[model samples]
Structures are given as C-alpha cells and as structure tokens.
Target: MKIGILTSGGDCPGLNAIIRGVCKPAIQHYGMEVWGIQSGFRGLVDDNVVPLEEKVLSGLLNSAGTVLGTSRDMPFKRRFSASSEDKPSMMMKTIKKHGFDCIVCIGGNGTQDTAYQLSKLGVNVVTIPKTIDNDVEGTDVCYGFDSAVSIATDAIDRLHSTASAHQRVMVIEVMGHNAGWIALYSGMAGGGDIILIPELGYNIHNVGSKIIERLKQGKPYSIVVVAEGIKTMENKKAAQFIAEEIEYETGFETRETVLGYIQRGGIPTAYDRNLATRMGGFAAQLIEGKQYGQMVSLNGSTIMPVPLEKIAGKARLVNEDNDLIIQGKRMGICFG
Candidate 1:
C-alpha cells in the first residue's frame, strides 16, 4: 500500500518526530511506500510530494518543525475566486496520480476537520493530533502540549527571581486562543501567584485586589500567568492589560512578557517525543488494517483510534471545577 502524509496548521515541536514515526514503520514493518506532502493540503492540490525512505526518516525523532513543511490553507473552505479552481477535486487528482491508498494528516483541530471532509469525499484518511493548546477533541493530550508547557513553565520559573528582586508583579502570557491548557498547566507548575484563563473569566478589579492583598501580606513580588485568549479591555494583549491594570489599581510596579512563538519552537521534550511516536505508529497501524477515516488519539494512558467525525469540530476545554484550578484557589492563587 502507498500512503501520503502532510503536516498542517501552526508548526510546533514534535511534528518531525511524528513524521518519522509514521514513515519508518510504514516503510520497514508494513512494507508500504510513503510519500511526503509539502505545506499541508495546498501541497496535495499542487502535487508537491516526495518519497519518504528509511534513511530520510532517521534523526527526526529529536528534531523540531516538519521536514515536509506545513500551511494553514483550507482546501475544503470556499475561496472567492473568478477562476474555475476546485481545490478538493485537484487534491483528489493528485492522490490518484500518485496512487496513494491513504493520506495521513498530522495537525491540530483545523487539519482534523479538513481530513474529515476528505474522508466524506470517499478518500482514505487518518490523522494525528498535534497542538500546543491541548484542545484537540477525543485526546487526553496532543503531542506538542507537553513541550510548550515545559517552555512556558521554564519562562515563568526564570521570571520569579527577577520579579522578587525588583519587588514587582510580573505578568507572563502564553499561547492559547480558544483553550487555556498552556496557561493553566504552566501557571500551576511554575507557581504563578495569579492565573487567568479564558475558561474562567477574570475581572480587572479582582486581579488588582489580589496583588494588593499579596503586598499587604508582606509578599512584595507576585507572578501572574495569563492566557493569550483572555478578553481584555481596548483589545490589548492579555499580559499587557493585566500588568497595566495591576499597576494602575495597586500602585505596584508591573512588567509583562509574551512568550509568543518561542514556546512552539525547539526540540520536543522526551514525553512529547514518545507521545508523537505512539500516535504516529498507531496511525500507520490503522491504515495497515484498512481502518480509514480514523484519528490516532491518546485516551488516558493508551494510544487508540477515534472516528474523525467525532473529533472534527469539537474541543476539550478547561472547566471551573478542574482539580488544578481548585488546588490553585486553595493555595491562595487568584484565578483573576
């Protein structure tokens, strides 16, 4: 059997690891020919592909980013065009031209949705979820989540010494647009004094009061971890808004740090590399068994297959009753 693979959506650590996982097993164990598709679905439409042999798959387990490249292009979405260009049909032609029996899509939520669309079109499809947000549905955790959390946690840990020395409130922002997994996990792991996430709405007054209370309790410095998706007045960034509000209301010197893309780049942690390898190997297994239209997922401690339809548009979000949040509250860490 011949299989094609592509990475889609925002690039993150563990992408190359997953690709290696898929290619190595499919090439050696299953005796399947593997094709690497460049720049996600756009590559499929443009017929940009290369053969994946065992030698090219080596040394990728510790690498960051994708060797096949990635893009955010949605071929299933309608493009307002004057030309008669049907992207999905063009992708089908490419698949047939290469005689690919199945296409393995490795990406986040958007890529899963696109894979589902292709499956409905009678194309064989399998997916592996990869995202730093950890919001992909039907999975306990995505591949890049642990790596990103490690990076964010390290940043927060480093900021503590500076915050204490300067006697200031330091606000650090981590990525998470629709989910707060990164901020929540990093905040708790890094000992953030106050954690604000989109899942649990925060009030500026409450945030200010928390800093003031800390100061009154002889705690001269505080750490505030903010999710980037958190709503802020005047459309300011979450960390900047929280820092400005803390200084304005509590008269404390405040500083903001946006970790940004740094968290998404770099070699993946050992845990993430293992998770990616497991998910990718499972995807190849599913394809070998002719179980198409499925996505490789981690349920608890097990790596398994989930129907693509079930995972397409859904998201796993942090709830108010989460044990971490409850523990943070008990520890006098303000949620606001």
Candidate 2:
C-alpha cells in the first residue's frame, strides 16, 4: 500500500516524533511506501513530494519541529478561473496521479477540517491531533500541550524572584487563542495570584481588588497570568488592560511580558514524544484497518480513532466548573 503524510498549521515540538513513529512501523510492519508531502495542502495541490526513507526517520524522536514542513493553506480555495477546476479538484488530480491509498494529516483543528473536506471529496484521509492549546475536541490532551505548559510554567517561575525583589505586579501573557488550558494549567502550577482566560472573561474591578487585598495582607508582590485570546470591552489587549487597571487602582507598579513564539518552540517533553508516538502508531493502525475519514486521539490512557466530522471545526473549551478551576479557587487563586 502507498500512503502520503503531511503536517499542517502551527508547528509543534513533537511533530518529528510523530513522523518517526508513523514512518518506521508503516514501512517495516505494513510494507507501505510513505510519501512526505511538503507545505501541507499547498504541496499536495502543487504535487511536491519526496519519499520518506527510513534513514531520514532516524534520530528524530528528540528533535523539535517537522521535517516535511507545514502551512495553513486550505484546499477548497477558488484560486482558478470560473471555467477551470478548483484547488481541491487539482489536489485530487495529484492524488490520483500518485496513487496514494491514504493520506495522514498531523495537525490541529483547522487541519482536521481540511482532512474532513478531503474525505468528503472521496479521498481516504486520517488525522492526528496536535496543538499546544489542548483545545482539540476528540482528544483529552493534545501532544504539544505538556511541552508548552512546561515552558510557560518555567517562565512564570523565573519571573517570581524579579517580581518579589521589585515589589511589582507582573502580568504574564500566554498563548491560548480560544481555550484556557494553557493559562489555567500553567497559572495553577506557577502560583499565579490572578488567572484570566478567554472562557471566563475577567472583571477589572475584581482583579484590582484582589491585588489590593494581597497588598493589605503584606505580600510584597503579585503575579497575574492572562491568556492572549482574552478580550476587554474596548478591544484592548488583556495583559495591558490588567496591568493598567491594577496600577491605577492599587498604586502598584505593574509590568507586562508576552511570551509570544517562545512557547511554540523548544524540544519536546517526554510525555509529548510518547503521546505523539502513540497517536502516530494508532493512525497507522487505522490505515491498516482501512478506517478512513477518522482521526486518532488520546482518550486517557487509551489511543483510539474518532470520526473526523466529530472533531473538525469544534474546539474543546475549559468549563467554568472544571476541576482545575475549582482547585484553583480552593487554593485561593483568583480567576478574574
């Protein structure tokens, strides 16, 4: 059997591990020919591919990023003329020419949507969930979340000493576009006094009063962690708004730090590598069973396949009554 593989959307730390996991077993056990598609759907539409040899798969388990490259390009764009075929048709033409029995996509929500579209177009496709935000619906935890949470937690940990010495309110911004998993987990682990997420918008008065209460309790400094996707009424950045409001309300010096691309880079954590490996192997198993139009996900300790339609275009958000939020409240961590 012939199979094609691609990684799409934002790059993650465990992509290489997933590729290695998929390539080795598929080649050795299934005797399948794996083709690496470059630059996501754009490469498929353009017919840019190379064979994924076993030698190329060696020593990639610890490496970060993807070897086949990635992009956010969608295949359904109407790039051609009215009389000509659409981009998805062109991609299908390429698939037919190469005779790929199945295509494997390793990416986040958007990538899953693309795979579902392709499946609807009569292409056999499989997906593996991968996002640092941990917002994919079918999986309990995505591969890159642990690595990103570790990075964010370490950054918050390092900021504590400086914040204490200067007696300042430090506003640390983390990346979580729609979900609060990253901010919630990291804040809880890093001892953030105030945590704000997109799911539960924050109140400026409450945030300021919390800081003031901390000051009254003889705490020299406080840390506020905010998700980047959080919005203010006036469309201001959440971290900047928090800092400005607290400084004005409590007369405390405040500073904001945005951990932009730092969370997206770096080596994979051990958990991420293992998760990626398991998901990748499971994807191969789905292909072996001829289970198309499905996505491989981690459901607790078990790896399983879920329908692409069930997970595509849907985000798993943190509930207000989530155990983490409840524990945070119990531990005296305010979610403002």
Please name the candidate that would achieve the greatest TM-score relative to the true structure.
1
TM-score to native of every candidate shown? 0.98, 0.97
Q: Please state the error at residue 155 of candidate 1 in Å.
A: 0.4
Per-candidate clashes come to 0, 1
The local distance difference test score of each candidate is: 0.93, 0.90
Clashing pairs in 1: none
Candidate 1 accuracy as lDDT: 0.93
Worst 10 residues of 1 by lDDT: 76-85
Tens-digit per-residue lDDT, 130-194, candidate 2: 88999999989987999999999999999999999999999999999899999999999999999
Q: What is the lDDT of residue 250 in candidate 1?
A: 91
- RMSD (CA, angstroms), candidate 1: 0.9
